[model samples]
Target: MLHPSLAFEKGVPSDATAIPMPPPAPPPRPVDLPGVAPAASTGETPRPPERPAELSRSAPAGPDAARPAQTVKEDGKAGPSDEAAKAGETVKPTASGEIPVPPPRPADLSGSPLAVTVAPLDDSACRARLERLGARFEALPAISNGQCGAARPLKLTALADEIALTPPATLVCETAEALARWTTEAQVAATRDLGQPLKSLSIGTSYECRGQNHDPDAKLSEHSFANGVDVMAFGFAGRATISVMPATEGTPEATFLTAVRGRACDFFRTVLGPGSDAAHANHLHLDERQRNAGHRLCQ
Candidate 1:
């Protein structure tokens, strides 16, 4: 039997304290917190603030702000802390506006001078060219088909006189100059026969270093060295008759002889025919007197 003034209320919560009420449930924290910090009284946020969001149990918070509030993104977090940029570390902007810089461009090359020169002939190279040309060098008086002998001055008087008696017939040439001229011409004519090689020369009558008329006592003649020329045949005339004499009246032999003899005067310094002498009846001969080396008549 409780009186009206002293009795407790009928449905009062069991956990209620007497004087003051505690706060509702608090946010979770990493540690046993002492107390919450006082919120800013200035009404502005410290970091870049997110949009005003509705209080939610289903949505995220604070992650949407990509940068700080006041400073630009680059100046804000890009490099060392604010202390290092002040220490002169050469920081620069990239095209993408990140921290590290790109490398520099190269310089120009338009003003340089350039040239090419061939190396000169060495001993080995010169020997190679000579060997390829079939040049054989010898001391002195070396015999038969030697290079120097082929280039020698004429020594035999009879050989020279005999050569002087007529113009070469059929591809004949006299002087070394003339011979060199005829050399290529003769080759062009000879090689048309097919399959044969181009040889250096087969000059049948270069000057002969022989005694004059086989006479050792005679004055040194043009044939003493190898300067005079006697033409034998052209293009395997071995198979053809080499004619330089008088005609058999008016036969084709006469016409053929005349035609070939005319080609001779083109190359010889002196030209002769059967009318020149009995010894010249068989073949036409030619030589370079240098004085009389263009063309002489045998009439």
Candidate 2:
């Protein structure tokens, strides 16, 4: 019933409501096309395409950025691997797929007390005799003071038979030669009588730069020239020790001590023991001193 011009005009009637037509159905997606994504409904705007994780990871980090450091085990601790790098070494894989280990370092002996070494004595004759008797000795320079000194000194460590001296001694070669003979003849025989072989001799004194009996005003003692030694006790292999003292008298130990003293007179010019003066009470003093008319003093 409305006129043609009114019907074509864009106006709403007072009593009527307008029903909008649904947006044209979205253009049919091109299912047959390759590499083409389906479009969204016409009214909505499309979001930018999402980037792939691989592309994001391929981006390069700038220099000066911190990198993950390698780990190394040091002294049982985990630490950075800069030590090897600083040393100009590289960690490379071996043919067997194993890491090569470094060689172990030798033990440090510089600070050890036992590291001290003494050179061998320079006397050929003395060295030959010691070598023949299986004695261990080191050559030492002359020890001198005022009018007293020991020349051609030797540091005795052990006998030829591997008998170790509890405490080694320093002596003149001549005295050592005499002592070696005495040890073979007197000490060995005496200890054999007791069914206990001699292990070592406990020496009280050897070389000293002092006067007789440590008297400051007296003449030089035989010890000053390394021509004397004081034997305090004899140690046997079974931990048995016999000291030269009056208390050991009236026992088998006394018999052995007396026998050795008697035998020592043949080798030493003077031999003093427990019954001698107070200075020689606790030990036997044997010395190779020049005597008058080849006479010997054995007390």
Candidate 3:
């Protein structure tokens, strides 16, 4: 019942005024990735995307590129980061990295110098040094009194260049060495200020098992251990004796005394002279008593 020109295709309704066709699918769309170029129609494997310009610049380049980063350690070494240290893992440095060196800790930053425990004294070596310094000394039997005595004492009679220790000093080798070294300096001061070379050291107390300043209840003196000496006066070859008592200001004796007392501090851990205290007003007291943190007593 339809004309040849108006016949509908299969599945179309015969009574419809017009018929609709299914739309064709859109052409395949190319992906638009961030920081990536659109694929080329040529399709040469669509070259792999590159790192963004900003990201590429963020990496370190050139000679230091391979060097490992450094972090400060608590002990003042340069090594790994704190997190790495906490994990207890060892990170080997890259070939380009230098071996890390620990920096020296400054004394002021630490409030004091590093603590060094005193080593046991080497007696033979000390005696050899004493001999080389031209001191005449002999070992004395060990003296052991209650809370006082020298384990290895020495009888020191003279110092370098025949400078006498009047009444022979009973001391330790270490003390003798200190005295000899100090005497050498004294001789220089004598010639310069007093116009003569030192002839003798009028020794007051070399080794006595008594309390400090001769007090019966106070702490024992360094002399109890043969570690201290009291120089009552300095005798020169031809100049008048200069006692340790106070001298006239601006006089050569005063200048010499000041210079020698100051120099004694360099060689002795303790140096007490006139004006230090009533107990030590008449003589120069030099000793090698070790104190905490290398503290010195130079009053």
Query: Which has the greatest lDDT?
Result: 3
Instruction: Give each prediction's root-mean-square deviation over alpha carbons.
Output: 29.6, 26.5, 22.3
Q: In candidate 3, how many Å is residue 112 off?
A: 46
Q: Can you give the lDDT of residue 170 in candidate 2?
A: 79
TM-score of 2: 0.56
2 versus 3: better TM-score goes to: 3
Q: TM-score each candidate.
A: 0.32, 0.56, 0.60
Which of candidates 1 and 2 reaches a greater lDDT?
2
Residue 63 of model 3 has an lDDT of 81
lDDT of candidate 3 over 1-299, digit per residue (tens): 77534565544456554667799999866665445445577645456579787554332468865555456566667765444355443344558875444455576787666799554466999899999999999888888898788788999999998999898999988889999999999989998988889899999999999999999999989999999999999988776889999999999999999999999999999999899999999999999999999999999
CA lDDT of each prediction against the hidden true structure: 0.41, 0.73, 0.84
The full ranking of all candidates by TM-score, starting with the best, is 3, 2, 1
Residue lDDT tens for model 1, 1-299: 54433344653433433356688887788586665455579654445567566542222236833322221233344324243244322344468975552232235544555578444223344334333433332212323443223322222211111122122211211244444443444344334432232232223444455553446676543444444555543333234433444668666456545654565566655555566666455555555445644335533
Please give the ranking of all candidate structures by lDDT, highest first, separated by commas: 3, 2, 1
Instruction: Name the weakest run of 10 consecutive residues (lDDT summed) in model 1.
Output: 156-165
Model 2, residue 50: distance off in Å is: 99
